[model samples]
Target: MPVTKLYIDKEVEDYSNVREFSSRIDLEGEIVDDQQVIFDIIQESSDPIQKAKEVIFLTRNKGAFIKKCPGTSIYTCCGYKILHIGTFCDMDCSYCILQTYFHPPIMQYFVNHIDMMTELDRIFEEKAIHRVGTGEFTDSLIWEKWTDIASKLVTKFSKQNNSILELKSKTVNIKKLENLNHNGKTILAWSMNTPHVIKEEEKDTTPLKARLRAAQKVESWGYKLAFHFDPMVFYDNCHEEYKDVVRQIFKNVSPENVAYISIGSFRFMPDLKQIIQKRFKESTLVYGEFIHGLDNKMRYFKPLRLKMYQAIVSEIKLLAPDVLVYFCMEDDEIWEKTFGFVPDKDEGLSKMLDKRVAKLCGLNKGLLI
Candidate 1:
């Protein structure tokens, strides 16, 4: 039986309101248990909530909120700032790094919202144009089936002006966000893939069609949208498959409504190859033409990456030329070859992304990056 461990800081125990929220989910086949572990370090700990933050809510082998984002690297790039909400995904994907990123992988969520909010408040107070998201470590909406967490985040972020919150996910669980006071400050983004990839590599994820349908619904509700084509798997007939995905996207939602679209070829840590071999033997993505990048990560050789990038960029430009398009973590040479410019030429990638997000969210200038 899968079990969910609930950790509550003594400070917010009375106001945590976790039980009230958990009761709303129709959980089945999992042995759910609740415990109150007294946190003594909150009194003098620089970030007492840090410890509570570490006591991740896990199911079996899954973990949550493992580490802060390490600085000084641009390869594992997402322009937005990260909000490390939880780790491990409930839905399994053959090429997922989380399987190896976390040992004995289990689904875990951090219940230490008080500390999280405290940290966020500090960042938000900077009033810099910043875009932040919580989907990096896990699928953002997977927990929506059982928790109203996204809704709460929407409600919280709606009150902030400087930062735009992006909730990226493969799931179409936007019900929690439908009626929230979003203020257009939250960008509901989706990590998209070709239907072929969805059907073959991604397991238990929302169908590609259903995901776009949901994006259309959200756009109709006056929310800015974003899409990601990360891990653009290279396979026979992959170009046609990906082109079809781009077409389907514009059919469902206008490019004008999109804030940005990110295109990244498949890349992974060298260690992840071993994990995929041991756990997901059927996945051929690991066996593709790859080379060790300067950052020591295994990525598609430059030519292959440029090929995929140019193809996707051309297709997306046809549909939405003005929408911001950028690669996930490619460096100067690849950026110039693919996008015609480099990050530093535009005051760095992070700043450029901050401006794009700020403009889309109607935030004041110079608020992030």
Candidate 2:
């Protein structure tokens, strides 16, 4: 979606990143003091949540830039670290948690590079392998249109030897990354869904074919690739559609080049249903055969989720037996039933991903980069 307006924080008016972004992002709307102020302003509006989507708030964050993901122990967590660059997304997916996550759901970008890098310095000093990603709070590359965030992050991670940066997105903003020297330390990932889901649910995102093509472009540029069939929407005859997506992925890029592929069925918090229903009146993707799961969120019936996961996992294994395939936010029981084993036998989810990083990107305990 085109940013119709810009909300600049007064504190960072002279900041270089702010100046750079202000020059590109359309500055055509009412300015607010900051993100919270913007939320307050929108609250009195006719539709605060909807209006919030039109404005982009630029501010300097006053917290730790890097933090551990809030993965619950109820499920086998991925143990991935989250780089909290920003919150909310530009895309209008039907099942977005941000719809109810924030009162107004403003698209906020924290422009404090010095502090962010300072925290990362500590992580880099640790000898342990840390797998970090920027997609936890927002679409990783949404800042591509307004700032040099992706290129800067890639460049920063390039010099690091232990941790690999995963930049996941639903957009095709690979222009800035195509020529960068990433040192094979950055995984260019995309959250993909079936073409039908893309068309009906993932509003304003790059089409499935376009996203795959973008991934192919980055793969040719020597960057490791990853994919997530996350929130894999369940619909009529989803088996063939998902299978087609899996095949097309390998067709566009080699399996050897793919670092990992994560498969997850559609799951959401109970509070999210009304927001999705209100925001996307035509969408029924959230109204599936859902039951309350261990995490207190509504999930597809275990047997149903197992069926879909089993089918997709089977197809992926048949095509690329050696590739690392895993589930996102799923429990050990689901893993055992579907894959015939859990990740516990092989260290854990975090170490497994680290091993994938070491094997695919050539990082190891002996050699850093």
Candidate 3:
């Protein structure tokens, strides 16, 4: 973490978790009644994005903690839920949609764990299979060094049987998660890409081998695992590179232990193009063959996306015939063209993933009724 300045929301200034987090960081913090003061300072910087990485804010979530994943009706959504724990990330990626998602993005960690847990309790009481993840808004495990949030959530979920908590990240911050009796309720996931993509696009993230090694360690500790190839870049020799990544995944961890694998091509909002041009000078990710998608985002041409998905899915099927592989925010055309069949519209992709979780995690009553 490159955090240098800490700001606390007046509402949570006296929170015990905030105090514990403050003590862990070697810096003095300022408590402000309003967040605009901190936002103003960051906006005045020459590089607001980089400046945001150097600051951390402690605050309370004034809204719902669990929200539906913002998926388009035109696309086949997985029916995933977002556990909004934070707002921004410490790492920098050239194709990150978050760069333009927030008006002025800043690293925020919500200290109101009670409110978050309340949301989880309601979900558990529903007794339906829900796939919730914290990585939707930010990297899930990035705050492990300063807080006990990971242990608390893992232990809390272990006692429940209806839902699964997916903590996705690009970091190898798993030392604190070791030896916990997670009881297969928490799935440790990683946002994976080829080594070339990691080196060229992702900044300040763990290497490919190191992340897989961390996955191997966690698998040895009796935790189910998941991997995602989201925002996959298009470049020369990219197909072979992605195939190698699939090979590396099964090589490091057992296929039977993998809960699921998700694949999606690189797509971005139009506003993010200028941000990448200004921030990442050498990036050619935005110069691909892009067309306006039905969701009003810039997506690769249909044929281009289909070619890549077919190649990658073929490799995954050949390697692990039984492992569950799904697409994230893709249309039925792509699904049918790649796998020869689209997931049933009535059940959608979410139920398919829930079935995989039940089989792998030993949850008997896993259907979403």
- Which candidate leads in TM-score? 3
Clashing pairs in 3: none
Go through the candidates in order and give the clash count of each. 9, 0, 0
Among all windows of ten consecutive residues in candidate 1, which has the lowest summed lDDT?
A: 58-67
Q: What is the TM-score of each candidate against the true structure?
A: 0.83, 0.95, 0.98
How does each model score on lDDT?
0.72, 0.85, 0.90
lDDT tens readout by residue for model 3, 1-369? 489999999999888999899999877889999999999988999989889989999999889999999988788889889999888988999988888887798999998999999999999888588888999888999888788888888998899788888999999999989979999988999999999999999999999999999999999999999999998778889999999999999999999889999999999888999999999999989988899999999999999899888889999999998889999989999999998889988756878888888777866563544
Q: CA lDDT of 219 in candidate 2?
A: 89
Better of 2 and 3 by lDDT: 3
Assess candidate 1 and give its TM-score to the true structure.
Answer: 0.83
Q: 142, model 3: CA deviation in Å? A: 0.7
Better of 1 and 3 by lDDT: 3
Q: What TM-score does structure 3 among the candidates reach?
A: 0.98
What lDDT does candidate 2 reach at residue 173? 87
Residue 240 Cα positional deviation in candidate 3, in Å, after optimal superposition? 0.5
| Candidates arranged by TM-score, highest first | 3, 2, 1
Q: Between 1 and 3, whose TM-score is larger?
A: 3
